[model samples]
Target: MSTSDDDYYSDGIDIRDLPKVSLHDHLDGGLRPQTIIELGEQIGLDLPATEAEDLADWFVDSCSAGNLPDYLKTFDLSIAVMQSEQGLRRVAREFVEDLVDDGVVYGEIRWAPEQHLQGGLSLDQTVVAVQAGIDEAIDDAVRDGRDIRIGQLVTAMRHADRGLEIAELAVRHRDRGVVGFDIAGAEAGFPPSRQRAAFDYLASEYFPVTVHAGEADGLDSIRGALFDGRALRLGHGVRIAEDITIERSDDENVYVSLGRLAQWVKDREIVLELSPSSNLQTGAIERWGDEMDDHPFDLLYQLGFRVTVNVDNRTMSATTLTRELGLLGDAFGYDLRDLESFQLNAAASAFLPLEEREELSERISAGFEAADNEGA
Candidate 1:
């Protein structure tokens, strides 16, 4: 689709030029298909698709299967390449490069170290490799005159019993490169309550957290995310829309009531890291509809939720943060101010210290203000 004012979009600014902050991105989910193929070849792992372009197409097709397990199957190939220290470093480096290309000034890349241990790397070693890559990329970006900051969100598989371990790992690396902790996997059966030990430990240490909740499940899962996980943010918590009861509507406005869970998430300003393309592909918003237009993003924004846009998985969803914002602007007729609001939401929700978050917010506001003046 033309991102310019041609047929597809006329958001009054180059979406690519507008600075963005990505809070729910996944490290494994953002690998280039060609990189996967090359790394797999190095390790003698044959791929389902031989050609890089074909492999890219395969991933989009695979993730569109609309269930977490099916979506997760696409990761086998990417994770296969990411088994070694070299592989992890290369992918992490490229991840930041891609984010910079997408105009992201800040991003939190989440991935599971527990899964990468199949290749014999200890969790600490894998983190070291990933951090080396992040620092290398940061230096490269500085050389290129683009400043970006990225931190890791260490994740534990919900089906496993290593939440407490992963939580400790996250805290251990807090000053090194780690920013937060998360639980990712089957949500329906594996509730956050099951990881109470991890959550309690993280809470005691005052570690920030964001859980994948209310996407595959409903209100109870969301509650667990907040109370058990003590989530400072939510990963694709689109299904929280379920708690919003629309009682009546007129031509001008719609009347709705927010359930307590929904109310708390909204009032607390808990960031909703909503990925439009990924949510549709993963069926996270199937209760609403199968298409982007059917998404509750507009409703949530209208109802005062802290909805921040993200490209959860760049390769899997065949999207960039710019493309995601462009599609949303096209769909909702949002102007630069609206887009800035999303960025501000992400900046405010970052795992950074309060002073740094305020600085980021100021920088963002300055950029948008400059853009506004140019338009004027």
Candidate 2:
């Protein structure tokens, strides 16, 4: 049940081969170290580490800080190298390729286009370059006999004042590659209500939204994301566990109750895009515990919350979907069925059309069924 460099298996099934849907992956956070070095050199950008392995180590080390702000500081390097059209294109193409290797059949890569415009590229231009890269990667995967699909989730930094602009940009490119809109970045002081204009616009346009809440803040922030931003999914909504109270404990059963917010989230089936390693790295679950076993993911799952596993930042966490699932299995003694349920939850929560989502669910079920048969 432990994941090593060579193996990521759970319940006698190779986790690497299981189909996954990545709902909270970040574009600027998942770059390959070598790609950063090469892109940094071309852009005359000074890097913390010139060597790939050393750079990778630096990212992991810098992001291990048990606070959300400190953990996010490592992104300056990754985002610095992603300013130009070429950098954006290459990073995006490789992002999808890496997802394929991690067994992600469907991934919604989220990034702030406003941050990538420092190189004089317009918001639309940056989106176009990224979509071009995604198209190329999908074609390459098809040629290699691997069926993979990707969608872009355009994000607006919550601290910034460009929410309306970013929301418009996402909708503008909806036909190209953008499938949804999101608000990320520092989620403590800036609630989704601050960007009411943007959310209202997205709502008018009937666009899907996922907001970063319950990670760096508490229930109030999540309430704003739900009511103000009208978010359909919550990014790292791990802190919602704060609203759950354990009433009593017995040898046989532990009685618990959910607050109004938690009850609403559970009743509405709002997808919680839970990133296990990222939650730990950012201190999102510190109130519960400091280790993986302390994560509220199991509590939420057992309570019928629609929970899904994700690698928020592949480079920063030095993790893959396979590795995240393995860690959860190790922590919770989960079997193949538990892992399959996570995938099904994610597939059902994807931003695609209902028909496409159903197709994705079928693909995931078929893949897990094959693995189960092999294990049997």
User: How many residue pairs clash (N, CA or C atoms closer than 3 angstroms) in each of the candidate models, in the order given?
Assistant: 0, 0
lDDT of 2 by residue, 1-376 (tens): 8757757787789999999999999999999999999989998988999999999999999998899899989999999999999999999999999999999999999999999989999999999999999998999999999989899999999999899999999999999889999999999999999999999999999999999999999999999999999999999899999999999988978789999999999999999999999999999999999999999999999999999999999999999998999999989999999999999999999999999999999999999999889898
Candidate 2 wrongly placed segments (more than 4 Å): none
Best by TM-score: 2
Which residue pairs collide, candidate 1? none
Best by lDDT: 2
Error of 2 at 158 (Å): 0.7
CA shift of 180, model 1, Å: 0.6
Model 1: number of backbone collisions: 0
Residue 53's C-alpha lDDT in candidate 2?
97
Q: What is the C-alpha lDDT of each candidate?
A: 0.89, 0.94
Q: For model 2, what is the alpha-carbon lDDT of residue 59?
A: 93
